[model samples]
Target chain A: MSPKTLYDKIWDAHVVHEDTDGTCLLYIDRHLVHEVTSPQAFEGLRMAGRKVRAPEKTIAVPDHNVPTTAGRENPDNMTEDSRIQVAALDKNAKEFGIHYYPVTDVRQGIVHIVGPEQGWTLPGMTVVCGDSHTATHGAFGALAHGIGTSEVEHVLATQTLIQKKSKNMKVEITGKLLPGVTAKDIVLRIIAETGTAGGTGYVIEYCGEAIRDLSMEGRMTICNMAIEGGARAGLIAPDETTFEYVKGRPHAPKGAQWEAALNWWKTLYSDDDAHFDKVLTIEGESIEPTVTWGTSPEDALPISALVPAPEDFKGGKVDAVRRSLDYMGLTPGQKLSDIEVDTVFIGSCTNGRIEDLRAAAAVLKGKKVKDGMRAMVVPGSGLVRAQAEEEGLADIFKEAGFEWRLAGCSMCLAMNPDQLAENERCASTSNRNFEGRQGYKGRTHLVSPAMAAAAAITGKLTDVREMM
Target chain B: MDKFEKLTGIAAPLPLVNIDTDMIIPKQFLKTIKRSGLGVNLFDEMRYDRQGNEIEDFVLNKPQYRETEILVAGDNFGCGSSREHAPWALKDFGIKAVISTSFADIFFNNCFKNGILPIVLPQEAVDTLMKDAEKGSNARMVVDLEEQTVTTSDGESFSFEVDPFKKHCLLNGLDDIGLSLEKVSSIDSYEEKASQARPWV
Candidate 1:
């Protein structure tokens, strides 16, 4: 057999049929569905009178439009449109016989977070969802990527996807990360290094000492924003760290099955001799606790940097930089740390895991959120919320004058009521700083959990290292 | 889906790079299960202001481009989020073809599935068409999927590459779901072998 990259190995395993034109019918092992993107897909299935080919392989949750407030279980609490969408998912899930975690279910949360927590996203599997953040599952070495709603419907009806193999790109980071720096910073720095379109048409395999040192939760954070860098998916090869995390999970293979799975997973790494279409290397130490200063993730800079002037950019990019600056309402040459924030949000699939809560709590202990500054902490999932409560991390946040809210994708895209008002600036832990992503005319500065917590205390985009 | 053989219409010019999905149709508009009715809200935030009035400066709101069935955009058009609604809104707004220098992978794929032809032309060709599109409603561009070429009012033409399978589906207005059902036997046999080889999945 020829030496294979991790992506190639996974791709080869899932091929149900191959066309002469290189298009392949790939079997899908896991499909995570959420409210915002699945309604039209389910409607398509109904129009075609098709049944879900593998209901057991699908999981549905209502996260995007569900409020992160008390009494959120009541559909009436949501806007009519949100209520209708959520209700539609409930009807479709029950009618289709797929497993569902309602808003009231203790297991309900963000689809990406819920998938790994239940071990549904496993190594060597092809996992997909209608949400772009489906790349989050790549942390488990799964051939995971986001699909369009049309593809979502196709998968439901056939349990197969038409796919063309993506070129392989390898991103390696070396050296140890500095204190107060996290996986979010590493990924942000990578996006800054490679422009927003750098990873287009390629699947990036994140590797090297820095990547291996991260926990699975950290790995998830890195892969979650692979879309921000324009990659369909970013993955890490499964190793001992991955095995330990998957062990004993509800859906993970057990005993002999586990041993057999491990045997194949151990072979999931790219061969040293395998060819790569592109290679990028970064020094981990060079990355600071980073924050995005513009409407795009590619506009990231270290906390110590100044807002860039449009003239600093060359042609084609100068206009984009000017437009981003205009939308963000930042002045040229202003220190990033000097910018004030009206809101501080600490949650999303990007930074809503247990470790994220802990990191924020560590910074908030015995400290109060700046007076008159609003801050909130919405854990990624109900289980994650419960774990934080038991660990007393929730108490730390509440004591720091932060709103301890229910779990969902709260304030991430602001589909719910947790949104920034017009022209309000926020220091957020969610992915995507695109205009109106959090709210209409709302300006979002993406940061890590600890950085967000630090910002909450200082009422500005402050460096966490200063507090530490 | 509509069969897209050829389209001859005014091409609206939007030269901004990285026009993400959120800008196509904001999240608030995504709650609707239906694909239609989104044409009014296409580029909702840009086309309208906070008070719900149309922004006259936006190209789409201009009289000349109001009936545009094609769009000429800058590089990396549709660069963020895999919301299929982006293409749905474009299709609903009567945009049958979009010519760009480059496109995001997921968005490019979504466009084809929705009966919209996304033509990726070289920078020089795009520049020529972009200037031609600036001629407003009078400049009727021709996009022929059969010939895989885009021609401007001045008769300048640029040929593009389209995947054979994708082109077939677009030309025939055939959905992949119906096509895959025809191969159920192959799928069933592959699953049988796959289960034995790796039951853990």
Candidate 2:
């Protein structure tokens, strides 16, 4: 067992009780729901004759299925397939008495992004959502993770969840990150080294020089994919970066309470003698801009690497590799740089933050997108969109052949009208590379925002280093 | 239904990885917030043909595994998008326990709230269970939810542990809000003190 880190301290504080079986019943401080998963849970409550257990603690938003196009006359005019889905979420949230920030809400955005911007996500809270990106909230020094629909129902009715304690894993990234290597690159490098399932059965606490140097948005991006590497959640100790990010948010504490909150947050770090079940260290400068070439996040490679051949895998893993290759329509031993893309999407809870937009805009500056490639840039939040426009980044995107759209989850899962045609390949900034994750039979290559922008200009999988 | 005294039955074998929520229940079915009707459409894409007929080759359609109550799955068993429908469909389809080498954090937590026990076992333990599940459809396993132990038909027993707090709540069927309400009196007292000290609200 490790000495209490901030994560352990928070866990102990929130623990209602422990069972003989070692499972803990945790009280969720905040519950964020979206259209996709909340409806069924609400239905389960209705079936059991139960009202929402604590409506005030729960906030709902329509993100995954919301359209990114600025304004549409009606739901019917929204030609995207996910429009109907968003409307359904709208109706369901209303009937359940949950506070739903609809698309019309100036605050509307991806659920993970919306939670933090609205000050609904706070430090020392246990937050859960029906989206894996729920881990994004953990950057604020909270114990946040994603949940499923059945659990959603349970929380709706009970406002608590049963969970087993996870082993502690500390991944210390030392040294300064090299230029052109962002937090996305660092996480991708970790995934590449550890494989996707490396952090399973553990909550990973990131520390050391490189991690502490990242901005709050950058830390959020790192924590967001704790799930991608099979970790329960990823977190960073709250510091000046965290405090500065939360300073003037709508729900953040004010005045004396604010000072008290900062004092408490500053205490959120691992003790010097704290031990972890596992510890892995990596040099930040060694990481490069990365992209996924296979069907899983782990099947990623540096932009300069060739597509892996089936023979590259050991033993029975070759079959899965072959299957992924077949689904992706990539030839064995092909140069990854030669892979052409038809669409470029630079938004999602994963990379919709203002910093992500700016990173992409920086690469798009003075470069025109390929003649036939379709590109769209959706901001993560209204504030992010407004800030980008104020900074003149939106105009750069528009001039570079990218559609500057309203803040929403756009082309992340093809839940909205934005989708790839059958067999089309896209450079997407969203997490996940499962077959048809963007649409029916649509192939996707997961990349960073800069990589997505670089690919948009080159119309292929080009190394972002060249543009940077 | 009788207090869910003990969880017992065969654990089905599913070797697939990264089984996402969308695959468990498609996006089209998300229109209604209701959870009851989703079980039938669970794994619709894999279970059905292009014409919507049940695919004979699908794992669930296999005769021997039809009545399985426990699912022994592969690594990252619940990955990709987070749709709670995955667990709902699994529960409604009669799965009570999911034993795997690993599980996505969200899906793992979701299992407990729905009365589904998601067990994380070492690869060796999972391999043994997978073989046991593959032997026959009627293979029986006993899971004492109270004891936190899983026993196979051959009398092999594995002692597992859950958080004591969650155990009490599950045993009493209490949730977070319920637990908080249990302490309402104390909260009210604190509120009264703060109000008196401030005299403003």
How many clashes in each structure? Answer: 0, 23
Off by over 4 Å in 2: A1-3, A16-25, A43-56, A70-73, A78-99, A150-160, A314-316, B1-12, B49-56, B62-70, B119-125, B128-201
Cα lDDT tens digits, model 2, B1-201, are 213458768777776666666667666565554656777777776788657898987778888778878887776787666666777788888888888777776776666676677787777777788778776566798878788887887778887767666556556665554455465454445445634432211
**Error in Å for residue A438 of model 1:** 0.7
Docking class of 2: acceptable
After TM-score superposition, the amount by which residue A46's alpha carbon in candidate 1 deviates from its true location, in angstroms, is 1.4
Q: Which tens-of-lDDT digit does each residue in A120-237 have in candidate 2?
A: 7777778888777788998888888887776677677666776677888899999998778888888887877777778877888988899999998888888998888888888888
lDDT of 1 by residue, B149-181 (tens): 999999988999999999999999998899988
TM-score of each: 0.99, 0.87
TM-score of 2: 0.87
Candidate 1 lDDT, tens digit per residue, A1-468?
777899999999999999999999999999999998999999999988999999999999999989999898887788899899999999999999999999999999999999999989899999999989999999999988899999999999999999899999999999889998999999999999988889999999999999999999999999999988999899999999999999999999999999999999999999989989999999989989999999989999999999999999875678988999999999999999999998999999999999999999999999999989999999999999999999999999999999999989989999888999999999999999999999999999999999999999999999999999
**lDDT value for model 1:** 0.93
